[model samples]
Structures are given as C-alpha cells and as structure tokens.
Target chain A: MTLILEYPNTQLKECLIEELQLQCTSWRFAVEANNLSPWNRIPEECANYIKDYMTGKGYQFDLDRVSNEAEIYARSVELKGDGKDAWIFDVDETLLSNLPYYAEHGHGLEIFDCMKFDEWVENGIAPAIKSSLKLYEEVLSLGFKVILLTGRSERHRNITTYNLIKVGFHDWDKLILRNPEDLKKTATLYKSQKRDEMIEEGYRILGNSGDQWSDLLGSSISDRSFKLPNPMYYIP
Target chain B: MTLILEYPNTQLKECLIEELQLQCTSWRFAVEANNLSPWNRIPEECANYIKDYMTGKGYQFDLDRVSNEAEIYARSVELKGDGKDAWIFDVDETLLSNLPYYAEHGHGLEIFDCMKFDEWVENGIAPAIKSSLKLYEEVLSLGFKVILLTGRSERHRNITTYNLIKVGFHDWDKLILRNPEDLKKTATLYKSQKRDEMIEEGYRILGNSGDQWSDLLGSSISDRSFKLPNPMYYIP
Candidate 1:
C-alpha cells in the first residue's frame, strides 16, 4: 500500500514542480517587463505608501535629489549668451505640488476628480517644492534659459502663470501650456514636438525634468533628463 | 470680438471637463477597490517597491503587525482542552518566506525561473518569519492544535517537512500537502474540502493565517483570519 502510494506521488511531484516552475517564470516576465494591463488599479498598500511620501519628508528628499542632479548639469553647461540655452520643466508635481488636493481626494489612490482638481487649479495656492525652486534659481543664475512646458490647457495659462509667479518662479523665457487643438496629442507627442520646435529655433535644450516618463521619452530629449519621483499617478 | 473668441474656447473647455470628470470617477473605483484584471501584472514601480520592502523594514513591520493581531486573538481564545481546538497556517510566506529565492532572482520583479527556484527549494534552507514564529509558539502554548496546510504537492512532503521543522515550526498535529491525485482540484476547492474534513474530525479552527486571499476565503474559514502581505506574486 505504501509503495503504491509512493510511486504515484513521486510522478505527481515531478509534474507539479514543473508546472509551478513554469508559472514562476511567467510571473517574473510580467513583473520585470511591466507587461500589466493599463486598466488595472495600483494596489492599495502601494497607493497609500505613495501618499505617505507626498505628505512626509520622503517626497522632498526625492525632489532634492532631482534638484541636485539638475544643478550639477546646469553648472556644467556653457551658456551661448544667445538666448539659445534652454531647460524644460513640467509644471505640476515637478515644480508646484498637488499634495493638498491629493491629500483630501486619495492621492491617485482613488479615481481622479477633474472638476475638483480644476477647482483646485483655479485656487492656485500650490506652493513650490523648495528643492525645485532652488534648482530653478541656480539654473537661471547659470544663464540657462528656463522654459516652462506643461500639459495644462492654454485656457488656464493666465492662472498657471499667476500660480508660477505666486510660487516664486520668475522670468521663464517661455510658458507653454497645451493649446486647445493640442488636446488630441499625447503629452509625449505634444512635448516632443515642442522640443523639436525649440531646436529648430536654435535653442539648445540642455536638460529636461518632469515627474512622468511620458514627459521625457520622446524626440528632442535633452542632454540630461531628470525624473522626480511621482508614484501618485502615471500620465501616458 | 473678445466674447466671440472666449465663446468657442469656453464651450470646448466645458466639454473637456465633462469628459475628464467621467474618466476620473472610473479611476477611483478601480484603484480604491482593487477592481483590476486578474491576468495583469503589477505595475513595475509597485513591484520594485515591494521588493524593496521585502529586503527592508516594511516586510518586517507587516509580519509584526500580523503577529500582533494573532497574539491578541490567541490570548483571548479559551481552548476547550479537547485536542479539537486548532489553528491553520498556510506554509509559504505565512510561516516561511520565499523572499530569499525571489531576492536572488529579481524578487518577483523579473520572470520566475522555475528550475532555479525549484533548486532553491531543494536546498531546504528557507528561514522562518520571526513574527510568525512567535505567533506559532503562542498558539501552541494556548492549547490549540496546529495544522499546516500547503498547496505544495505530496511529492515534496519530505523536503517540506524538513524545511518546516528546520525553520522553528515544531509539533504540528497535522501537515497536509496536496496529493498527486488531487492535482486537478482548484486551490479554493481543494483546500475547502480539506478544511471540511478537519471540521468533520471535530477540529475547531479558531484562527487561520495566509499570505494569499485564497488561503483565507473559502468554506470552513476560521473564526478570524490574518493575512500577511505578499505582493511578490498571486496564487490562483
């Protein structure tokens, strides 16, 4: 009886292990390769942890790290003195934080509330992340022309400009928000095209910084790209 | 002229706001509720961040949290002194973590290499989760019988048994592994049946703990269930 049981168990064990091994291999691929579906929600613990970072010193440290990188790159660039040395900065989360809005509304842990966020935008009370602000000052002193490029619509340009200056940003060579007709373009496409235009206009984009991957992945990517941590959300 | 220029832009802005608002609501439901595709992989950042936790203090804190809950419940239970009072524990990541296996192989961040993992398993060197170990001892002293149920197949019984005892788990009244013939059963179905059998045998399962939701959510569930975090992978 024991032998009969042992015989089948041995065979089954081998098969089961093989199957489990295969399953493990596939799981590795999915995770490492980012092969997940777009519609899937971020896990709750992860979402909350990200929110915590935003509320805590962790977020500032990350911004500081990005700023440090920006400063190093800025210091190394030799200015042409022809208004051709440029740096692109994404507006939301990269310069001004959206923490207060996110803190009340789930910080990307829940679905976005556009009307609510739009109202928050209109309030325009977002404070500058001190690190980014410091970097902004450093770059301007280094003679790198700062160009503000954001996904916010052109309709909000007046308010966006107000907020930028209110938060201590000054003298950006250009502040380019998305045009009404540019709404159809993905952030990457729109931003990439804009960078291409800058290059055509003889401006050398020395560096670009943003909180989203889409902000940095397209054509005319700068000599250096700094990604500030923004686990709150992903923009396509 | 000013009103005409503003009219078209205002109408478009309202239309855009309406569309964006709808998208936001759907995002909230999906994220906060974990309404995601089963087949989808975890987001890469989340996966890597979880791996960071496994190697850092986050995992220990989670294990500590589970143990704390277990201790409070264990202390409150008054066992009837009948060998019938029991607690169930799912083996992997509940008592012994596969973190070491995952750490060397991308911590579930990369594709699972089955043969490599199986080789790791064969080494029988998995260490006990300290928090779970404390809880294991606490319940044993509380006069509740311990039953270990794992999805690992019967063929692995020798090594599995060795690993458990080596990892500070001792004197479990029963250690149940899936039989070769039981390979066709779903984890929920198979485990539920085993739990039913325990019920038939008069085992009063006061508590159960597992890393997988499946391990806790079926027929014959215990009076209370504790879930230890395991973001590395999911079991069907």
Candidate 2:
C-alpha cells in the first residue's frame, strides 16, 4: 500500500499561522502546532489542510503499517552500550535545520548548491531542531553515548564536526566519514561496513538516528534506529 | 549486465562421462579434470555436445564469478577460527546425494510425502561427494570448528543432526535449525540471523558449505562460504 502524507491547504496554513501568534509562549508551541498534537481537538479544516499539504509534498508522516520491528531492534542493539544504548546522530536535517538555506532561495531540486552547502558548514551556521536537539541532550545527560556518522567526505569532516560541537553535541565517541575511494558504493553500504567493523571490535550498537535509510541499513550491529524529520531534500 | 551460466552440450557430456570412467582413479577427478586440461583439447563434436547438455540442464560449470572483496573478507573471517573454522556442512544435496529419491519418487511440491523423503535421509542410502568430503575431513583434522546450520525445522533437527553424524560429519559445536515461527521469512534471513547470533555469542563462523543461497547467505558472520555442486534440486 502506498502511504501518503497530508497537510493543510492555504486557509489552514493561515489559521495555523494565526494560532502560532496566539500561542507564542515558546519554541515548543511551534512544534506542538505543527500537527504533532492529538487530532481529537484539531478542526477538520486544519487537519484536511495539513493532509493536503503533506500529500502534495510526498511526505508520509505516519508509518504505522511499516512493521520494521526487526530492523529497528537491530539498529537499537548497535547503539546500546554500558547497559544503556548510545546513539550516533547525523546533524544536518537529522538534528539541525537546513531550512534557512532552503528558505533563502526556494524549495525544489535546485535548492542544494554545493558551494552554498559547503559555506554553511564552514560557517557553522545551521540551527538545531529544538525538539530533537532537546532529545539528544536528554539522552546525553542520561549517560548515553552519542557519535556522529556523516557522508560529508573527510575534507569536510573537521568543519562538520566543529559545527556539531558548536551546536552542543559534545563528547562524541567517533565522527565517521566515507573513505574517498569507497564513495563509489552506496553510503549506506559504507556506513554499514564500518559499523560491522565496530561490532567486530566489541561495540554493541544500541541505537542510531539519521534522516536517510543509508545511515541505518548498513550496520550489522545496531539495535534500534530512530529517524528524525527532514523537510529539506538531501537524501545522499 | 546479466550474468549467465553456460553449460556443455550432450555429446560432450557423454564424452565426459566416458572420461569420468577412465579418470575414476580417485574421487578428485572432477576438480583435477576441470583444472588440468583445457576444454579446447576435446574434439569439436564432443565439446559442442557437452555444452548443449550442460546448457539444457541449466548447469554453468565454469561461469560463477566472485567479484566482491568485502564479501570474500567476511567469508574468510567466518571461516578462520583459531583452528576452529573447520567445515559446517548442510546435509541434503550438500554432503550426500538426494537425486535417487527425487528420481524414483516425484518432486517435493505434490504433498507431504514424509516416508519418501525420510527414506532418502535414512543412513547408508546416499554416498558423499567423495572429493568434497575428503576436503572436509582434511579441514577437520586441522582442528577447526564445525557447526551445521539448516532449514530443517526444529522438529526435524534431532533426526537431521543424527543423519549428519551417521554420514560422518562428526564433532559439531552446534546444530541450528529454523524456529517454527521464523518460517515466514526467507531461509537466508533465518540462517543469517542465527549465524549472527552465534557470532555475538563468541563463535567465529569460519566457513559455511551449502547447496543454496539461503544456507550461504544466512551466516554473514562467516569468513568464507563454499558452494558444493548439487546434482539434485531440493532447496527450501
């Protein structure tokens, strides 16, 4: 079955914008107002509008039927450590927003300009997704390990790692990247191979978080995998 | 991009059968003959005949390619135990011949013909692949691990395990079978999961010998996977 994401129409978008102004208490309102709340109290018009918006963009927010329990469990195992699962997170579109870059221009295939992307990373510019960043810090405070696995080649690893540190993802176990030659294969395979090697070295991967499937599928060792929302369109 | 297996024809098959008779000094004729002489040395008529026979029977005697180095390394790791990566072989069509049963009776899809299949698995019925069996024994003598993984359900595990012992695959560290509930997934995944679990439990999967992809693919933890020629076809 094809799963479809739904979003509100222009009218509902306007209403939500108004609601945002009314509930301007904190950044939490922005998140809560973004259709994450229970739909019981939500007006039909807003719900329909949100559904239409999501469907148009091909984003299926709800994945109830996708029973990836086995895959999830496998991912979680890779993250678990010291009796607590440690997570390695990818920043851009995983924990941070590339939206500023997208918004400054437009939303489409042409949105990603490599030079601009590099500049953003070099400048340590992207802002973290507050909700997920909060979750990341919570996991860290609770003594879970957090590492970063990225596709930004080694050339960009330093800047990317620094950006993560600037944004408060501290004490990372490792920051991994694709070996230049191995880029010929899918990034998922490369990451998975590295994760498997880590497993061989005696690390029980308890959990992994990423915005793309490649970040999760390659690890032969992870137990649980959590995918954060990515409104921006980078899938590599 | 399509990798096809090419086989020798019928006349060449008859000639090879005759050659087999003449070269039957040891069970090593298959490997030795294929390695020692070029196919071009055979008469044109004989070559064409063998090619036709092989192609007609869907046999690609010499076309299989091993292209992935990562896969090779993984296989090697699975097989190389500190003298523990002996040979964990599967039974039906792997070590013993099952053609007689299929030839005399009908195929496996008709119904539950337990008696017929059971008689085939019963002791002293089928002969081992002499050359491969010799290799297995040689590896065993070197003091490696030997563990069998099979698609046979747990209910039949006892009987299947016993049959292997009777047929001379002695001294196994473990005999694993498909749990009844896990039957829904492909045998390859089942075997792979079991093998991974074993690897996690500290047993290095050195080598796996199987007649089907399911058997070979299951143990991603293994170092090397060897496929034995299966004259008979019964893979589940």
Candidate 3:
C-alpha cells in the first residue's frame, strides 16, 4: 500500500510527512489516520534513498539513536531488573542487515523474492547491524535476558540459529520463530502471544527493538519501543 | 498479510488450507473468522503458483466460469434490463492482464514496484483478458450502462483511458479513476462511494465483476457479483 500526504494545507502535510517519515508504522497509521488521505505505495526513489542511507553514516545515526534510547530505557529499568527482565529484538533488519540480498533485489521496494531471500539467509552471512550489535551486547551485560523473535518459518530455525551465532549474537535467552501452530497467526499476534508467554513466565519486558511496528506494538509489549530506520520493506 | 491454516484438528486445518489455497482474502478472513490469528505476508510459492495459473488454462477456466455466471445472471435479469441498469468493471485484472509486467517482476509476491508498473502501464501494452472482453460485449448488448471503476490514481487517467480504448474496450458510459478527493479511501470504500454516486444519479447496478473481492463486496453493490480469480496481490 502507498501513503501520500494529501492535505490541503501544505504546511500541515509537510509536518505530518516529517513525523511519519520517522517510522514505517507511523506512515501506515498516518495513511489510515482520519486526517490523512489513502496512500498506494512508497515512491521508488524514496525507497532506494532509504537503502542508500542504510549503508551510510546517517542510517547508522538513526540506528545509534534508537539503540541509545534502548540503552537509556535499559539503564532506567536496570536498578529494578531481575534476571527475568527481557529485551526483545526482531531478527531481520533489527539485528541483521540483508543489504547484500536487497542490494541485488530492490530492497523492500521490489516484490519480495522469498526463495532468493531464504537462500541469502541460508548462506548465514548476514552481518549484524553495528549499533544493534552494540545494544545486544549492552542489554546482556546489564543482566536483561535477550529474546530474539522473528516471523520466519520454523523450517529456517537451524539456519536462523546459525546466522545469529555467525554474526556474533550469542546466548540469547530465547529465540522464537513461527512454528506449525503459528501458521495462522499474524506477526503481531504471534509476537504478542509469545511475549505473553514470557510475561506469564514472570519475565518483565524492559525494551523492544525492531524495524517494523508489528514487532513493537502489540499486547504484553515492552516498556519502551525503539524503531530503527527501515523504509525498504514493511511487515503488515 | 500472511494467512496459514492452523486449526488443532488436522482435518479442519487441511480443509481450511484447501479453501485458503484458492485466494488471499480467504486466508485473511479465515484467520479472523473466529478471532483465530493475526497474519502477515503471503506464502511466496502459493502466490507464484497463482500467477502460473493466471496465464494457464486454469486461469482461463476461472474467468470463463465467472463469465458464465455473469451471463446467466444477466440473462435472468434481461427482462428487467433498461437503459438505467448498470454493470461495473474494475480496470486492472478485471479487464486488462498485467501478466507481462508481473512476469518480469515477481507477480504480487514481490514488493509492488509502482514506478516500473506505471511505466509498463503507460506503455498501454496490457492485453485484454479475452473472457472479460466477451462479457463486456455481451453485457452492453443486453442494454446495461457500463461503468468503469478503478483504484488507479487519477493522474494515470490519460494513459488508462488510452489503454482501455487501445485494448478494444469501447464506449463505457463512464470511466472513473481515484480523484485527488478520494485519496483516503480503501478500494472498497472508493468503489462503493462511486456506486453511491451512480445510485444517486438514478442508476441501478445489475452486475459486477472484479478479480479482488473488494471490487464486488462493498455498498450500493450490484444485484449479482461475479468474482474472477486473482491471488497475485491484495489491495486493503
């Protein structure tokens, strides 16, 4: 779906655009927002521009900003933290960069070639997004359990595990992927349900980080949500 | 969003799976049918398979099947037909085949590259889906006012009109594109609103055919709605 700012007032549209530009979910919500017009798709150039930033310092700044906020939240909750306090991280984009795969493909702008992407994942060569890696290391050091949750099918569990370890993400408290039972679940629902399980286990979720809003905006969510820059693709 | 059949009973799951295998929205509704699960992303292979069928005899059969139903309904309603009776046709996939464009891309399985698609559309090389063209001729001859409704942005009107004419769809009473004012509507909402306008203008919609369910499911709808098979992409 596309989102276009169609307000009569150029100033207001610009303002909303600025705000919505910050996150993919924000744009989605804005498109559905009563005040805004319906959107069909993101502009290709804009999507490509985001990809350019992804490998640049500006994109790194965005990640660093999100990771920094996560750090602050993690610290705030640290004093009261028990071993059960958890920080959730989404697998794709949040923790790992698929730039290599998307580089040949049109980032998230092109129709997703699942076979090609899965092959890339199976290669277990996706490196960690530097800032997220830093956050990952910090969260673990601060005594919060790291839970890696992804919408990936369970069939990729082995490769996903290998990729995570290969990229220096080690000893996560739990790694959750879509099992057969979750076939009918939306990423948001599946994620929320999984978080509820963690909550039921008495784990306090302190912070969450993901590229998509679905990963951060559901039931039993963490105290703070940190969204990194990702305009290439969106998870509904 | 993805849809998976995940009922506890293997038989029920299989049954649902079989049904959902037919369309994207089926899986969407099934997921939320009993408040079952939240889903994200369509299956890549299933989407591709649907694309395969679209160019094959299976797709033709589906079109012929829908056309036959339309013809039957039209014949039954022929006695009541008048100059004021209407039949609505959604443009893309309803009357035109985007196979050439999607073939180069990944059908709807890939992220929609609107720029490339629009360029393709501007080429106006999209061939008419033969069955739909036949249905169009049959309906017009039966004394119904034909209304062409599409979710394409209004700016594409010039190319759209040219394409429709070049593809041999002649003399539609009205050709409606999403105007600037319709920027906030869902496809269903936009089409329904247009139908309401037509109703206000004293038109009685007798029949409707579209690949997506949204084209036929909304308000002020026709007496009979015939759906053509399309599982490539979904419009929300």
Would you list the C-alpha lDDT of every candidate in the order shown? 0.74, 0.51, 0.72
Ranking 1 against 2 by lDDT, winner: 1
The per-candidate count of clashes, in order, stands at 9, 66, 17
The DockQ value obtained for model 1 is 0.01
Query: Residue A62 CA error for candidate 3 (Å)?
Result: 44
**How much is the lDDT of residue A191 in candidate 2?**
78
- Each candidate's fnat: 0.00, 0.00, 0.00
Q: Per-residue alpha-carbon lDDT of model 3 for B1-236, expressed as tens digits? A: 12345335677867666444434322322221111111233466466455655565555655665676677677678545456888999999889989888777665667776798889988978999888999899888888889999988888888888888898898799999988889788887999999999999989888888876568655786766666655566665
The alpha-carbon deviation from the true structure for residue A198 of candidate 3, after best TM-score superposition, in angstroms, is 39
RMSD of each: 24.3, 23.8, 21.8
| Native-referenced Cα lDDT, model 1 | 0.74
Q: Where does model 1 exceed 4 Å of error? A: A1-41, B1-236
Model 1 TM-score on a 0 to 1 scale: 0.46
- Give a tens-digit lDDT track for model 1, residues A1-236: 99998999999998866444333322222221222223233445455455655676555555665677578767877888888999989999888988888888776777776788889999989889788999999998888899999999898888888998998999999999888888999888999999999999999988888877567757887877777766566676
Return the candidate ranking by lDDT, descending.
Answer: 1, 3, 2
